[model samples]
Structures are given as structure tokens and as C-alpha cells.
Target: MQNAITELEELTLNGASRSFLKETAKWCKFLSIMGFIFTGLMLVGSFFIGALYENLPQTQAMPFNVGGMMTGFYLVCGLIYIFPIYYLYQFSVKMKKALISKDNDVLAKAFEMLKSHYKFIGVFTIIILSIYILAAVVGIIGLVASS
Candidate 1:
């Protein structure tokens, strides 16, 4: 009877461990999705900003003020940037747990994706900042030339 009880306890413990692992995997998947979404949205926003600038009438474009757009864009981008960092932190925790459980495959996949995500954000920032600086320089030159 005692042997049977021990076996049952072991089974129960194993079940609980599996449940924990399942939850961790779900979180990993969620983080991956969020990373992809953030990257996509940033690219889309860049396109929208470009289109808006191109569509504006040149006559009124000289005194363009993006105070409102700049405020909102910065707020959204700030949140987007913070999210990946938070995800990478969470992934490190999850990967540690996975490694202890001998789930090295999952750890490898998650960290690989996390690394790619980090690079994606870096590229997005470089492109966006370049465009923003170029626009400002051109605008300043135009203002000075007109004066």
C-alpha cells in the first residue's frame, strides 16, 4: 500500500511540473508574437509618416509643426521599445527554467528569437532616426535659404 501511495505522489509531482512547463511555453510564444507585432507596427508607422509628409502641400509645408504627432509617436515608440526589453528579461527567466528541466531545445529557440527581436528594433531605430534627421536638416536649410 505504501509503495502505491509513493507512485501516486510521484505522478502528481510530475503532472505539476508539466503544467508549469506548459505555462512557460505559452509565455514564450506570447513574447514572440508581441515582438513580431511591434516590429511590423513600427515599419507601418514609418510608412505612414513618410506618406503624410509627402502628401502635405508644399506651400504650407514650410512651417510644418509636428508637435502633436511627435508627442504621440514618441509615446508609442517608447512603449514599444520597453516591451521587447521586458520580454527579453522574461525570456531569460523562462530559459533558465527550461534548461533546468533539460529542455534545451526550447531555450535555444526562445533566445534565438529574442536575439533577432533585439536586432529588429535596432534596425528600425537607425532607419527612423536617419529619416528624421534628414528631414530636419533639409527643413532648416530651406528656412535659411528663404530668409
Candidate 2:
């Protein structure tokens, strides 16, 4: 393990690797910017959801405030989306700076941000998959009970 760590520490980026990293940083910046814009749009759209749902006849018949619930849902989703996007944005900016200046600390920080971004996404994916599985099980149980 120590040998592996030493080897990793000694590893250096070649010109090709640096070029690829620079290109990746550029793409990350573009994607992060797009994500931020969409998240902002989603948050803005959340406000309109209440108004839209208020006009629906089905929602009107419901005892609960469907509009408010939907707006809150959208807002929560938008807020949840911001973290990974911000991490990605930070990774991109830091990576570009690190590459340009050949700063090891900055590069490490940039990679840390990238790791955080992926980790957040991975955990989120697992949670979503778990919810899907739970929903499927509940649906099957409901169908069986009805029959």
C-alpha cells in the first residue's frame, strides 16, 4: 500500500495527459454552466407550478394544496441539483487554473471537487433506485391486496 502510494505520488502528467485534462476542464465548465442555468430555470418555473396547478380541475377538487406541494417539490429538486453543479463548476475552474500554473495543490483540490461531484451523483442515483424499488414493491402489494 505504501509502495502504491509512493508510486502514485511520483506519477507525473505528460503533455498529452495535460492537454486532455485541459479539454476536460473546458467541457466541465460548459456542462456546469448549463446545469446552473437549467437549475435556475427550474427554480423560477417552480413558482409558476402553483399557479398552473391551481387552474386544474382535479387539483381544485382535492382537499390538499396540490399547487403548493408541487411548487415545494420543484424547489427542493432545484436546491438538491445545485450542489453537484457547483462542485463541477469549482472543479472546472480549479482544474484550469492548476493546469495553467502547474500548481499541485490546486490540482489536488480540483480533483477533490470532481470526486465530490461524482460521489453526490452516485449517492443520489442509489437513493433514486431504492425509491423506485420501494415504489414497485408497494404497487405490487397494492394490486395483490385489491385482487
Candidate 3:
């Protein structure tokens, strides 16, 4: 096993790649800020949802508690959105430091954060897709049962 191990090589960024990384970092920071704002809005809206439901008589008679469910949904969205935004923000910060200092270690860390951001988004996408599929199946079953 010792013989099979090899020494790790250092990664070097070309001039163009360095420029691209800087540009990507800027975009990531912008998008992360936007994401945080949206998350904040959703969280605040979750609080107001119950108030709206209390004031609206039509929602009171509904079979399901739309206000509570909507609040829960919004809270979940905000919680879920936090991860990617944090990761993107971290990537942006670390990438800027790495570029300015020309530090390979920092650059690696930045890329790792970038990976985390995409990984969270990819998993979230799969979960949403699965939920959609399940909902479609349930809808079809309901239609058939009703008929």
C-alpha cells in the first residue's frame, strides 16, 4: 500500500483561469446576497401568513390549514436556501483571498466551498423532483378513485 501511494502535485492557475475565477467570485457574491434577501423575505412572510389566515374568514373553513402549511413551507424553503447561499458566499470570500494572495491552499478551499454549493443545489433539485413525481402519482390515483 505504501508503494502504491504517490506524491500530490500542486495546482497552478493560468492567467485566464485566474481572471475567470475572480469574475465567478463576483457573481457568486452577488447571487448569494440575492439568495439571502429572498430567504429573509420568505421567513418574514411565514410569520405574516398566520395573521393573514386569521383575518380572512374564507381560509378558516378550508379542509386543510393552509396558513400553517404555508408558513411551514416558507420556513423550510428559507432553511434549505441557507446552505447554498452560505457556501457561495464562503467561496466568493475565499476565492478573493486566494487570488489576491496567490495561495494554492486557499484556492483549494474556495473550490471546495464551490463544490458544496453545487452539491447542495443538486441534492435539493433531486428532492424536489422526487416530490413532484410523488405528487403526480397521487393526483392520478385520486382522479381514478373519484371516477
Best by TM-score: 2
Q: Write the per-residue lDDT of candidate 3 for residues 1-147, one digit (tens) a residue.
A: 333334235347799999999999999999999999999998999979866865676833678877788788889888989999999999999999999999888988999999999999999999999999999999999999999
RMSD of each: 12.3, 2.2, 3.3
Off by over 4 Å in 1: 1-71
* Residue 41 alpha-carbon offset, candidate 3, angstroms: 1.7
Q: What TM-scores do the predictions have? A: 0.43, 0.93, 0.87
* Ranking of models by TM-score: 2, 3, 1
Candidate 2 Cα deviation (angstroms), residue 1:
17
CA error at residue 75 for candidate 3, angstroms = 1.0
Best candidate (score: lDDT): 2
lDDT of 2 at 78: 99
Q: Which consecutive 10 residues in model 1 have the weakest lDDT in total?
A: 62-71
Q: Tell me how far candidate 3 lies from the true structure as C-alpha RMSD in angstroms.
A: 3.3
Tens digits of per-residue lDDT, candidate 2, 3-122, equal 777887786999999999999999999999999999999999999998898788782367789889999999999999999999999999999999999999999999999999999999
